[model samples]
Target: MNLVSKNWEYLKIVTDIPKDYWSTKNEVVLEKENLKLRRFKNKSKSSNNAVLILPPQAGHSSNICDYAPDQSLVRLLLSYGLQVYATDWQSARLNQADLSIEDHINLTDDAVEKIREETGLDSITLIGQCQGGWQASVYTSLYQDKISKLVVAASPIDFYAERDFMNDYVDDYPMEFFEWLVKLGGGVMKGDFILKGFKSYDPYQHYIKKYQDLWKMILEDDKEGIERYKRFYNWYEYTQDLPGKFYLEVVEKIFKKNGMINPGTIVINNTSVDLSNITCPLFLLAGEKDNITPPRQCLEMANHVGTPKENIVQVTTKGGHIGTLTGSSALKKHWPKVVEFIENYSQTA
Candidate 1:
């Protein structure tokens, strides 16, 4: 009876989703036996900048949507005949809990190299978002000649800024706090941890929004609102747990101690990864309303790149962290500039 009831409810939810809720599918290219990349195609002109995109902390899979960066950036770039391919992140469980940040770096860098080798080009541009930005910056610092241009969107550069609340919230949470959390999560990161990141502003707003949306779904028999909620549930729930060793290193060294900002504080692959190595032209996009990672945090990125600060351009839009990529404002104002920035840098670099 319980199973039947659940099936009935799920069927009802599916029936309620609106006809226009779905977007176009992106081409999933099998880059490797273990890795699949999302290639956003644009047939027009050709440029030297073959973009090899990196995903967030989620780890490595190009499962990007056509409507989002995959489509939007692809369409825009295609007009100029530029090619774009995004790297998708995989889950820790499937890959085993063996990867560290260094492993992630190797995966990304190797992909960039392979793409260039296949394309018969000497270099490519790097577009990094969120944690991907941190990865890009680190890569630029280390492999300076590989990337001709760097575009970091909605990514936090300065951990010292009051951007990530978890940084401060966990600050004094006794070292035992992590131990308790690890046990509670049963040795893996849970959906709750990821969802909590969206609650720093008026913690109740999310719950209230969910409550209102559910009511709207029921009252109007709105299938779209229902399906959107369901898809969001899937993504929000699908979180990869960080390795205990990596988590300890990230929180203690990167977030709390600001090891990333401090030149000599961190080391990867036996080599010191420092921001000072990023001497190439850089473009930084920061959402003004982003509560998760503030603009102030992103503002400091230009200072470290070995290039003149004048080469760094910051476009501060008024959307939230994720909204900057998905919402209307980004399409109208932000993305155009990003495309142009890449175009100009591509020709000149």
Candidate 2:
């Protein structure tokens, strides 16, 4: 192809994903700042027993929990005859860069209260994925009565329990490194940079393997594989900003300080967050292949929550971080176990 044709093709390839791309699969019942609570249609008879799902707002779109019809956590819950609600965490903007951990926790608390009132259910099941797991755990610890069953999938509770290149990278740099990053982003940490940092986790995947696979797919005329790649790439490349305050707090408090494991060490909104305060039945899921938040980080919560051993269930599934929640094999193997636990603790009509 000529230079002009190639440039035109490149222009066509530059896809656009809106800021509100994380908008829910169902009805958006409430929206505030960078937080949105969504309610999905219920086909189950036990719709009264509502469950609220929170997706990680790290850098990618919140739609990771419900990426497609077949790969939807919401759909799986609906199939089990359970009412489902999710938090669509909107992207942080430059002006909102100062938003803090307290802000996110408060917003989540607001969503939980709203879900409770809207459904008229005294308590709802809370399920969180990755970063959402941290948010959900803190929320449940603060308001145990509002949540009947707590589920955290692929979340890191004990940051110090495991070490990886990413963790070491952060540790090698002083807090000033993050400060400089925030300043470079004009007070907000650009999602593109965050995505780049994540890509560095496995440079082979980002730098070489992905493009090579794409080229192979093109040569083989694998339309289906190419379409799947496009879909995942669309979501992956479309990143969002994070409040500098929130980002720093996560690094300082959660990662550097290792707050979650040490009970009563972390304080939020005038209350010390103790995992032991969480008395509700707990369900913790971990991915064996997840290097980001290893199984140990997630499963240790079982030992912390005040819930009895019988009330705490932990499952280690096969797949990496993202695949644990959305992988096809995970949907068949790991997810059903989660639903079963939720159903047992969940209230019914």
Candidate 3:
């Protein structure tokens, strides 16, 4: 086809890209400020050890865990016959710009309690990924008895770790810089800003390589590849605004001050958070190739949690940041290990 024809066809394909389509096999049990708890349909024989999946709220939708049937962590958990629950944090809006870290943690607490009351399970296993991982740790520490087991995947804990590029990047900016940036958004952090930051981590992949791949698919007329790319890319292209206060606080406390592990450094609702209070069976999953939150960052939490060393399991699997979380191959190998670990500690009434 001629250049004009090819360009027009490309425009048509791009315009026809389906809306951010994320299929959920679960039902929304609770909804609060863009945060909702979802439970799979087969609750007939729920396990005493229910699983709660929390995807990072850093711009991307929670659908990352439920990206597709084959790439879904939700499907994997359901297949094991375990009662599964997840947090679906909606996009932040201008009116919700003042939401803070405490707000998120508190809402999560509400979700957890609701899950317990409904399921009659005393405690549930918490699975946190990336940003959610740290949030889970904080919640588990403050409410130790509410959780039976803890799993954090590809999450950053030790912010001061020498090899952490994210930490270094955060250090490069002053807190005031972030404050001003948030101000530009009128108190809400623009999702595109966050997207730009993520893309900045790897300009080639976000800016150049993806389009090259798309062009190749177009040229080769690879229908399957085209469909797969569209499915993943549409969701990726969709960004969510973040409450400015929460965004800045995370940049300050988690990334700048490294308060998560340090006692007296972080507090929630007037109560101090101490990671040592977490005595539950802890499982830390990291990606060996994950530069975003290197294995060191994810594994170091095991040292802080008071769980016996014998109760802690750390696995460094394959893939980079997003790959570790959603990569089909990594999920196939790493998630089964997680299921096995949770089973070991599960208790039924």
Among these predictions, the greatest lDDT belongs to 3
Kindly give the number of clashing pairs for every candidate. Answer: 14, 1, 1
Query: lDDT order of candidates, best first?
Result: 3, 2, 1
lDDT per residue for candidate 1 within 89-146, as digits (tens), equals 6444523444566776777777787777667777778888777788888888888888
Model 1, position 130, has a per-residue lDDT of 72
List the pairs of residues colliding in candidate 2: 44-81
Judged by lDDT against the true structure, how good is candidate 2? 0.82
Candidate 2 per-residue C-alpha lDDT over 1-349 given as tens digits, one digit per residue, 9 for 90 to 100: 8544544454346365443443235888899988878888774456567888989978888888777677778788888888888888777878798899889999988898898788788988999999999989999999998888899998989876777665787789999999899899998888898999888878999989998887776666666676677678888888888899999888888888888877656788989888988988888999999988888888988877888887778888989898998888898888988888877653321
Superposed model 1: Cα runs more than 4 Å off: 1-11, 14-35, 43-45, 58-80, 174-176, 183-187, 197-202, 221-231, 346-349
Stretches > 4 Å off in candidate 2? 1-25, 43-45, 346-349
Look at candidate 1 and tell me the lDDT of residue 216: 60
How much lDDT does each candidate structure score? 0.65, 0.82, 0.84
lDDT of 3 by residue, 201-317 (tens): 889998999989878777777767777887777777788889999999899888888888887777899988899999888889888888788888889997888888888888888
The TM-score values for the models, in the order shown, are 0.82, 0.92, 0.93
The residue pairs found clashing in candidate 3 are 34-90
- Candidate with better lDDT, 2 vs 3: 3
Which scores greater on TM-score, model 2 or model 3?
3
